[model samples]
Target: MRIRRVVLLMAVGAALAGCGADGEPIQPTMSANVGVGTSGTYGGVGVGLRRGGLGVYLGL
Candidate 1:
């Protein structure tokens, strides 16, 4: 699992490193996400938003 996560992160990093190579201006965009997880004794949900270079998150 650790190796897989490392590989996935490297792949994403490489992809993002190549973005905007054509000299195009960056555009503002808004996105929302939700995440949930649990362990042996606890779990929680998180909500998040990202706009351009800014981001926000809330967890419960």
Candidate 2:
């Protein structure tokens, strides 16, 4: 019986490990940028907001 309880607790812990503690978005972000300079240098930048429980993707 004690072993069963321990196994049950372990199973519960394992299940809970995959859940969010506060129930929020796993990932939310967006960004778009580009720059070109001399010597054929190129680069890009991006920005995003992650406050709500949603992941908004751009350029999809």
Candidate 3:
């Protein structure tokens, strides 16, 4: 009984400690484009942006 109480208290304390302030949710932006012309070939480009204003891109 005593051991159970101590274990329960520790579990509650751990749960409270884990409840930290939430951080700003990430808002991302993404874009892609593809085009085909008279030729039998295609091209595409993609861009991505993250919360910190960082950007990544790919093209083919």
Q: Order the candidates by lDDT, highest first.
A: 1, 2, 3
Alpha-carbon runs more than 4 Å astray in model 3: 21-60
Ranked by TM-score, the better of candidates 2 and 3 is: 3
Q: What lDDT does the true structure give each of the candidates? A: 0.46, 0.45, 0.45
For model 2 the TM-score comes to 0.33
Candidate 1's residue-wise lDDT over 7-49, tens digit each? 5654554454356457543332323345555643543443344
Model 2: runs farther than 4 Å from truth? 21-60
lDDT of 3 by residue, 1-60 (tens): 655654565454444434432654333333546667788665443333334454433332
Residue-level lDDT tens digits of model 2 in 1-60? 655654565454444434544676344343545667776755443323343554333231
Q: Model 1 misses residue 24 by how many Å?
A: 9.0
lDDT of the structure predicted as candidate 3:
0.45
Candidate 3 is scored at a TM of 0.34
Best by lDDT: 1
